[model samples]
Target: MRQQMLNNGQQRIGKGLQLSFVLLISGALIVSSCAKIEPVVINEPAYLRVFNNLRFKVTVDNQDQTHSTLVMLINPEYDSNGIPAGAEIIGDFLVTRNSYAPPYPSHIGNSLDVYNPEYPGKERVNAGPILNGFDLSSWAQVPSGQHRVAFYSRPRSEVPFFNLEMRYRTEPIVDTVLDLRAGEVYTLHVLQKDFNTKENGILLRQENFHKLALADSLVYVNFYNMSAKGFFEAPHTVKPNSGNHLLGGLNLEYDWFQEGIREEMNVFYVAYDERFLRQHYDGTIKPLASFMTHLKRDTENPATAPYWSLPLFFNAQDSIRSFLFQEFFFSRPGFDATPESFMIPNDGPEGPGAGGYARLLCYGNGREEPPAPRRQNYVAVPNLIVTTHSGEHNPRSFATVNSIEIVNNSVYLTTVQRVYEPPVY
Candidate 1:
């Protein structure tokens, strides 16, 4: 009986140990399952604010000639299915062909659209309230980093076609990569290199839009060389003088040759001198001789008269203190004299004067004319556009800005209307 008790005690010990082992495993599993998984806190991604400075009128092949309008922007990122991320409608401006001018006709429309990636096909969300042109005042926040930018030209009627197939169906007329930084402002200028062809392009310019501590008595001016070919020739010197020449002709050779788009050249700081003010009023301060260029249309003649001078103007009204130099075309005449003129039937060639075709007129006589060549004279004219801010208390709140654009063979200045503000993304 004692031996049986010993065996029973041993069994009871064994059972206790087994029970402990099982309990230990069960406790471990319970701890593991009930343990809280700390929720992952993901920080919001940073963004880069980008502004569109592109403005153009597009003509669709199948669409009405009068209804020519096309402008589009696309984000080149792709999803799991390899579909285009989406597109943002920059501007669908209707071309008002009022007259046969070189610049063609100005565009007028405010409607812009952004494609809805979540909902594909025929669905879109308005980017913002209808903007007159590409919203230069506002910005679009894109995730900061490397991104591909694409531009397309299509009829306004086809904006509903937002699928990957449709987005790339026509091929992007302008495709480029942008290494965008967070919290920076960049202006993307899309220009129509050739209005007749679909060869469109983009030019990028960064700007500092911070408020300035500008003095009322002083004005600041900078030269944005849009005349790519015109600058090829050496510029003359101009200096300030007692005569009608406000700033005497300083050799601008160095100034003109300074290469790059929107390069930082000599920024003129003009004090409100009485003489300069008088010139502004009397319009006597024409471009100095040094500022003039004797551009030759015919390569044969080594000598030609300087017919055109870079157009310069200044405005000291209220908040805007600026000096503008408008050099929209090549100083050389007849290179691409208005496109409309080409379209118009050439009234027979080789006529000397009026009605009669002069051989020397159509084509140069291959002889260098004296100072101020007597060939057809073409002058650069200044076109001024005034805009007012509705809600601003400061009447002179307008700021100075500039841009370079290529439409066909013409290079002109595009006004940057607004500066980029913060809290965008």
Candidate 2:
């Protein structure tokens, strides 16, 4: 797919910090300084499909070079026509002879120019500009259905822009009837598996956190794009019997530099243990009905972090819960405060810190189940958090960390939340 807006000044704060992070791990940060993007066009355009074997006649679209386009599938989300929605096309074959030169200044362009000591031009591969290879694949587990694929060039400026054409498969859906009853709780274990990275590794911001539905209570789910990096990469290793460890990453430091770093990060998901939730509340999860979000520190770069949600509202009447979860009178228009806070506490003295769950305001579409007091389902909307912190190496450098909070509300489903099935994947 074509690139969305990539020029955000908000990200500049982190570029320096990222460079510093690289420097600390490698003793020095490297830069190709002199890389050129050359486009290549194959005899046939690269073709991708839903669930089938494909041999794309890849082409490098550039000037004066027969650059090989490396294609890797990404974000495998299929459209109504069963084609990939988006993928990353990086240009690693280009090189710049000079880092500090006129015309080619040091700017973070779509074509990333990283320096590698072992390359022919001492220029490691970076995405974009010209000949960077493109990753074209289906999103993890392309839904078994018919969907359209969106094909387009990205970043706006390639030596010459290319067009995308898609191929798809059509099928039928069969329904099976199973005698199932409502009210009785069903135990479901959702395992989110994906690949990690050598740079900023990926972590499961959420695991099979607990979700309980009493008979016919409603449940709403929301999903959001947290980061552009590591969203679709996977096939990482996990420790024995560790369910929470779906999110993982590679050590860019060790991978880029020659470090003895051989171990990978294994993050475990905190399951919605009936015993734990029961221990925290009563044995029943419906009683503690609520929405929640918390922050988790990134082990690789403590400055970077992830936020999580805890059940916030529960088996209460909608009218009352709605009012309770409503935005605090003092909340900013954009909700730029503590995410997922509430104005009042469940049961406390009325006033300052005495009243509601500070900042626990619920907005957007909700599910319809049994009445409030009998409500069984709890949904979390989607939202995002962007944090800017001081860099570890260059005090002048700063890092901007963005996290996606797919509460049952707005971030993703926030705008689409409604009274029906929980909005989860």
Tens digit of per-residue lDDT, candidate 1, span 368-423: 22121211222121222222333433223233233322222222333333322222
Local accuracy of candidate 2 as per-residue lDDT tens digits, 275-365: 3332465434432222333322122221223333322223353211211122111221233233223222233222222211222112222
Q: With candidate 1 superimposed using the best TM-score fit, by how many Å does residue 271's alpha carbon deviate from the native?
A: 14
Best by lDDT: 1
Give me the runs in candidate 2 sitting further than 4 Å from their true place: 1-153, 156-294, 298-361, 364-425
Model 2 residue 97 CA deviation in Å: 36
RMSD of each: 22.3, 24.2
In lDDT terms, how accurate is model 1?
A: 0.30
Instruction: Please report the candidate that would top TM-score against the real structure.
Output: 1
**Worst 10-residue stretch by lDDT in candidate 1?**
356-365
Q: TM-score per candidate, in order?
A: 0.38, 0.21
Error of model 2, residue 131, in angstroms: 42
